[model samples]
Target: LLAAAERGDYAEYGGTSVTWAEMEAYFAQTTGFRRPLPWEPGEAADQIAGNIAWAEMNLDAAFEAARTTGWLDLDQYHQQRRLLIHQQLLRTAAFEMPAISTEEARAHYEAHLEDYALPFQFWMRHIFLSCYETHRVEEGETPTSIAEAIAGDRAAALEIRAMNHRRLVSGWDVPVDEIDERVGPLPAGFRLLVPGGPDRRAEVRARLAEIRESIHSEADFIAAARQFSEVEVRNRGEEIGPLPQRGEEFLPELEEIGRTLPIGEVSDIVETKHGFQLAMVTRRTGDQHRPFEDVRESIVSALRRERRNELMLDWMRGLLQGRGIAVDDVSSAEFAAADASSERVVARLQGEDPITLGELRANWEGLNAAQRARYAERPEEYLLAHLLFERTDVLDEIAEEESSAWMAPLLHIYDLVTVAEPFISHQIAEAAAQITEEDLLAQYGASPERYRQPARVSYDEIALRADPPSASPEEGVPDPTEMLMDQLAESLGSVNSLGAFRRVLAEYAIDLRAVTASPERSSQFRDVPLEAVPIEVRAHLASAEPNTVIGPFANQRLVRALWLISRTDDYLPPFEEMRSRVSLDVQAQRRSTLNTQWRSEALERERFELVRPDPLPAPSEATEP
Candidate 1:
């Protein structure tokens, strides 16, 4: 069979013929390398021939099964293959496009000069002090007002602290590295040190004014940034740019500063909701046209692609015109209203079968949701395109004459795979069914680690709505949520038992059941995997003893208090408990073993030996030009 397939005379498997081209195509698909030619000295050709013969045998068996059982639709399979072949032919024709000349490329460039115009850009750098940290809301939860108020307070404090640090750093004459030494190391919770300073915005402006007096040049400004910048600008030696002067890319105030500031000049402090910022423009460029030579190759490639698309569209139009199919008169609304099973003729070629509404509906339904939505948006155009593609006879003829040699073998393999899949699955299922209980036990005993379960925790939790404060607190007035949290914490501190904790929760009008239930309406988690728990919750639960009340841990949306009910370390379940899982494992092991045995038998029956080729030599260093 191998020799016949290689000789290009093999004709069996319900009149399906195999050729050397098909063998080469199969070899490339499997090995990712072209098979050696007849005259080439290698064992690869023999190996590829063996694979081809095996595939053909399987295809033949599948074909016989289909014929005997009348289970497969050969006509549908052939139609799908014809569509693939037509696509391959079109791709081949498109890639073999006519060469585009430099003159043509230049003309296109001249006509679309705006496409190559470079925007006004500049180089600038600044120290950034982010007053507020961005927070990610938990799934199925909305941000609460209390959380926003807390964040706002924290941001206000941070702005004050950042301004103080800026003031301290600006007064120093030491180098960027030594400035830290001059200020001394910061203690833990150092950021909260200047929480209630003078108006933060006024302080920020005053600090910037002092810094401006000391910064005579761009280098001086950079040194000041290195000393006081909250972000990582200190470590970077070069300024970031030529960034486009686009409003969306940068803060509006920063973009305006970058656009209007003279080179090597610093701007006044610009206030934003996040924080105060000062920018210095280091370099600038005016809007300019890209030189034709710089983008010539790209322009040529673009023109080539455009030309190819036009050619393909024209070819499709000609095919439709030749068949006397006029899709322009077809309305999407008509098709939309028609039943999918309706047998009304939508279009047809003279002397050919009419394209039915049912056929069009079936084809449309085959597309995925995204593709269906795209086509539905312009159904008339889609109809025309589909009609053109539906001309399978023309497609097959063109593909036979123009498609690459590899396309035939690829199509054959695709058909064989689709047909043989069910038979292969049935065979594997039969092999798996032979697995016994004893086999499952032996496999389970051999792989004890696979049966071990990870540690899990069972807990009950109470949740509260910690919405942001609706109004800002006046001077010296505590936030409403903060006061509530304080009272709850004080109340929980005196509760020593689970019953007492439950009483306290009830007193607070908190319902644990309503807060923790999942969207599926399932009860709160029990025996959930430790790794699956949220990191913050996991930290507290990791070492907590049973019956311990923990949390009041608040996120941007909720305050959660958890009571640990039980916990278990990683352990293996009893054999009876894991019987179903072990049985599945045994069956999978058997299936894999059978597949290996079959492949080995095929190799032995054919007397074929695989030979790996020698590795190519590495390239030597090139001599200097």
Candidate 2:
């Protein structure tokens, strides 16, 4: 400060925070009236001094200009942002429906009883005659005659498969080890049977035909199934229980066979991709209507879901149609090929709003590589949904109609606060130098609680969703949630390094693709709560340091492999470290007094009644100057 430098009171500050003593120096310098401190570097001191000298000459004029223009514009900007969000969230609570009654649910159940029937399931068994062969050279052919053409006859292959079916029907099977030795090793798409798996279809068809010839009764068919048959049903002698009702859930050939097979007779040879089979319908559960009590909950759930979906769909459709929403069909391949950086228009909505390529990428960014690949098959559905919900601003009319009623009072208060800020600061500035340096130091000493720091630490988390048991699973059964947890336990039970941690994740198929999560080098879980994380994992996070790999813990279906990248423990920084911050604290302290004084003056000058409810004061830092 000019007065201080002439009296020599300058000192060191400003690497991290301004302390109590140096806070005084900052006050003298930042008031825009004091000359630069002598402790400031040579050229820096003169440069700052010259700038302060110029500000000192026109400081009052600058404040007046700001009070007239800047704060008014800022108030409008804040109000507009609030209005946009406020209108979109408003609802009168009238649209929400009451819970459905039991009588209503039962009445609806009687009319659509068939819709609630359990899927046409079968209690049936089958005989599978697999075609497993060595593929050896025939007696007529020799290794010396390699140049000569070899047999590629389907009929010959069919004969061999038929002979195997005859052997299975007669209670015989080839040992898996012998088959494995002769066939070298089983190839891809052949995992149904252990050691030796599924066979080629030419043989499968022949085997089915042979089974049709051999199976004369339920006894014979069951006998043949016991001797042979592969896949999951082999354990139950080729019995596929709880038969699928949906065509898509099973092989087309098998579903057709189930539908047409006589109640007590053998099915004709069914040529399915897995193998050939002869089915016998042992029991049928589809003809009888299901009991009302058994389906009561489902019927009620269906009706509620139907009502909700219809309401939402109608609302969405009206919105889209009203806005004249239109889409341009961009093939997934074309969208992929376009410049990823460019804002090239992929589609447009309401004849005017362009949906860009970059926006489309962001739309699909939340899905993992597998999910993205799956969605690529239905590009139109993904794009249209994204456009409607995420990209389009649907609140324009609502904001105009409703924002004033909901937001007017709040906006008025905000306007008052923004407009009054600069004038309050000018009032504080006028009294700032008059307080005297000793009294300022006395005030700093009195407010030690202002320098208190709360305990704040940053942490990291790894979130993983467990894989489903079967790629194509039954609709209502609960899924297995151990996929990632089991893998992480086996793979990372002893992992030590970050490289090993990453390798374990890659091995187990846990990739971080959260929409808002970034894979930072350190401390990524500052906003995440400890309770949301798995209990087993919290110990590792609390104990581990940077680059430490620490989990395979599960919270419901999500399994994780957390890495504690770094931590920042809660402690107050040393006074020198907080000198700059303390300097701002001094300005805020002075401003609070001016604000209180200005409010009193405002009460006398203004005519408006205050309707705001007053609450007891909460302890808080003074507003920054």
Candidate 3:
């Protein structure tokens, strides 16, 4: 009664003189279908067919009223119907997206805190000096100590290089064919005439001297290197770093010094298994922890993705349940995954129809790789785990109905909605593509900090390890830290270049063997992060600049001196460079937030209901309302 009052159809019974011709014309105009006319020579239906003619008359009356008094202009009515169908389709996606709160995101972060920890990395540069160079000993001067022996060897090496320089510069104008014979076959790792080789050692030494002098006078090592060093890094101000902890590749002697080296200071020459080395500790960093602000965005995005999947699953379950779709737990049926084409029964559902392996396989191609994988990567087994709706032809089913004359017009309307619904995905793409260059830029602006690259430095280190004074702790030896410091200071005072540092180590009685004379960890430590082990070292590295000498720092029984090689600060690129990423992020964020609100409001307007099939019979088995 309420439904009749709502439609205002209670008064249609007045007069009641409607004829077959009138009803036939009305059905033709409204449903686009007509039956035999009263005066036409059509085959007369038997008495049984006449029994249902009144039913068509009643429904035709409804469609006619809707077309006229409902004031639906035929073309305008179809356009509006199409619009309504599209909106219904978009709502499905809109409901699936969900928004997460800050509190929720933070809770997730705390749970996964360890995942964000970055390793301890150090960006350092060093000048290496090998300890094995043969030095010239004075006639009748028997070496008394290790220092003397080393000094004699160092002097001899320098003298030989000086001779080589003289020959290369003025005297030995010998052709390439005679060069090796004259120099006694250039030593290993050496090539005559080529730059920074044996024949050019003297010039290399001289240039290093000039660079050292400039550094002592407070000139930048990177700047000096850009003007003087011979290695490939000279193009980059002689810097290398962003190195993490290392072993054999790094000289044992320079390790501690690199950790404690100041940000940008050049140090006096340091020596290793090789010869004299000039070093500058350009940069040092500790363990890295991405900032919470940057991490927050990612957490939110991840949570939303999870939320979307969960919501989609829940909605699909509800949709199916509403249509009396469910696996019949009582059935012993199972799909033969091994032979999917056999159309074997997988499970009986609440509906009388049982789901088959072939029916499930039909939709397999539409699933993504991950989705397909969920089915054990097999159509047969996958069907066991998932509940999916099989698509059907509503129009075909209606056409085949014995009651088609009565329900066909209503079915036409229903078919129109179902067919037009698929266009929604295209509509959604068009809507999403509304993202513009300006939108991407705006997105980038919102999370400018998230895009910043980690701080990195190209630096060189000068490591010098000094021995403790005493032989044994049982004998009341001096404090090892103190002894190591004194040794470093005394050596530091006498050295300015790699050559000078070797000479000083020889003078101070510091055994060349006791030092890790090679670049502490090679010439460059590549891209070391800012946070890591050894807090004192990290603090010193964070504060210094190019050419800065930070240490003489003492640790355990060893002492070290630091030099700065080079530094590279963290920075972000422009919006245009990362446009695609920015647009995706922006759209995702807006989708989540907007959909959160849209769903909450729209659900109030949604009309949904479920009818249990176990107790109620199919619609066709029951009478109409």
Candidate 4:
């Protein structure tokens, strides 16, 4: 049927041949199917015939509705009916997707909690102050230590204090944790002092009272903060969190201050190298292990997935049990007979067993190749038991242990999801297969403008590196001006043309390599170091043209470049060359059509049971009565 469609069989079945075969072929190509295969192993061809019948039923129904309801514009109605039938057919063949459950959602959620955990850091603001870099150089103390240099003399203490005083008014804020480790602990002298120092304690108290008045709203606090606070809060206000983990990531002084600050309240100015900051806790959430209530929706979602999986498995078991979709499980002995190539070694050692390759590799040889190489290099670091894989007894031991345990539940779940829903899977595959060769050609014909070649040009390069002092001792040797000028002149005269450039090296005792590039190629010489070439050669090549050569400017070594310009072969690929692309286009169009068809069919097949047609009173009636 698919082949017939690919040959445009459906085109003759209608008034104005709507190439359905082309549509199907497009689907197959887009999805990478060369041609459609027959339905699954046990499914009879009659089942495919029934699916086609369902597609026609939906298409006829849609066509009738369009005729009875004259509201549809002619061309649009035809297009819509085509799309509708395609969707309906897809769904009737059991292509409608199934829903996931809460159980599955929760399980997925639990597996990815790292995504939910807050970022492993917090925002912190701090002020910094330090002696000027120039002052350090002038002090002439390449210092035993920063502390010793600052504390050893009165002059040093004065410079340090002066630096801090200047920074009090100008320094910007920074994360305290980033401050120099050498600067032992934050000093108490860095704390904020009342304006007018000893005389204005009462005035400072009044300012704190005013700040308290606007603490109720973030907007009010920000406005008050900008006018009065000295901390470097940006124009938009401070964003100071995700606070780091409690015990591990904070300094003693910084931690104490952070932990003590109440929500919405500011702390007295804290100082670090950046200067001073009056910190505030804009928000705080206490650490509490989330309760089931908080995660119950997620858990329910997971439950639904698990339950759906269970239902799917049950469905698959029924199919395999009597529907002839799967063969019965064979005995272990029968299974063993199917694989006669493996040696059936019996262990001679008492209580020993033959080891399976999977078990041995899983328990031992599964180390990455590099690690395995290291292990092979030095066998001593690994456990003694892992090295016992050479013994045949390990297999029997694994077999005996296997008989005592049940398969893991997750494996059973996976098996069901895989085995169930064969019908839907089959339908999807059928829809995918409908795309064909003729369909591809039609699509390619429709859009000739889409496939064009890109512009291309060709060029070549010569690469040389400027020798460093260690690499070329001669490069470092200062040359006499007369000798240098004479060498430069000699190098410049080496290459006037391609033939002359090639032989110049033999005549002048200079070594050089030439490269050519065509526009069709990624020229290797583009990355060559021009500085390494003789200065005159570099300058000459810079101005040279296609099939032209100039050379012999001297800096380090001198060489000339020859280039060829090739016109790009920019043309659209032939149809056979672009068949795959056309196939893709066809497949996409088919799938979209099939999806619409499937939805339509599924909705028509669904049996809805509603007891009351007009359960609610109309708004107009309610208002009138």
Clashes of each: 7, 9, 66, 57
For candidate 4, lDDT tens digit of each residue in 1-625? 3334334423222122323333333334334454543342123332332233334334444445446764235586435443433332222322223465556655656786554454333344322221123222222222123324434433333234333442222223422332223222433222211112222333444555555555655566665555454333243245655566565555555666666666555566454432334455555444434544577676666566556544543443342334222223223343323332443332123344543323433444457877666444223222222322233233234333442443222222222222222334445556876877778788888888777554343334332222111113356543322233344346445444445443322222211101110011112343344444445544554455655433222334222234423324346778999988777777777766776577456534642111112233436855755
1-625 in candidate 2: lDDT tens per residue?
2333444322221112212223233335245434334353335553332222222333455446666755335556556655535433432211453367789888988888777666677768876654433333334432122112222432232233233341112223434323323323322222111111233566567666775687777778776666455433334344566677454477767766677787768887776433577778876666667787887788778778667644544454455557776556667786676554658776657556677877777667687888787567656556655655465666545455665886443333333233343445565676753555455455446665666564333454555554333223465433445544565577777777656665443233222211111112222466344445456765666677667666656665566667665554444455666665666666676767765565445433442222222333555688554
What TM-score does candidate 2 reach? 0.29
lDDT of each: 0.62, 0.51, 0.47, 0.40
lDDT of 4: 0.40
Rank all candidate structures by their TM-score, best first, as comma-separated numbers.
1, 3, 2, 4
List TM-scores for all candidates, in order: 0.59, 0.29, 0.30, 0.28
Order the candidate numbers by lDDT, best to worst: 1, 2, 3, 4
Q: After superposing candidate 1 on the true structure, give the runs of residues whose Cα lies further than 4 Å from its correct spot.
A: 1-24, 27-51, 69-76, 93-95, 120-123, 127-200, 229-250, 273-275, 284-286, 289-297, 314-385, 396-408, 457-566, 609-625
Winning model by TM-score: 1
Q: What is the lDDT of candidate 2?
A: 0.51
The residue pairs in collision within model 2 are 2-35, 17-577, 17-578, 17-579, 17-580, 18-578, 18-579, 18-580, 19-579
The true-structure Cα RMSD of candidate 4 reads: 23.7
Candidate 3 segments whose C-alpha is farther than 4 A from its true place: 1-97, 118-220, 231-279, 327-625
lDDT of 1: 0.62
Per-residue lDDT for 1-625 in model 3, tens only? 2222222211112222223333343344344555533332122311112212222233344446446765235576556554434323323333746888999998998888887776555565544422233333333322122133433332333333333362223234544443334444232323111112343345445556665776752246655554344343333354566564455377644656676656566665654433455666666655666667789999999999777755654564454556665532212134323334655565566636777666665666677978756654233324433554233222233234423454444334342222222222233344666777778877789898877766555444444433333145677766545655666676577444544433332233332233212212213354576553156566677778755555678555435565555656678977777777788787777666654454334322332111111332446846677
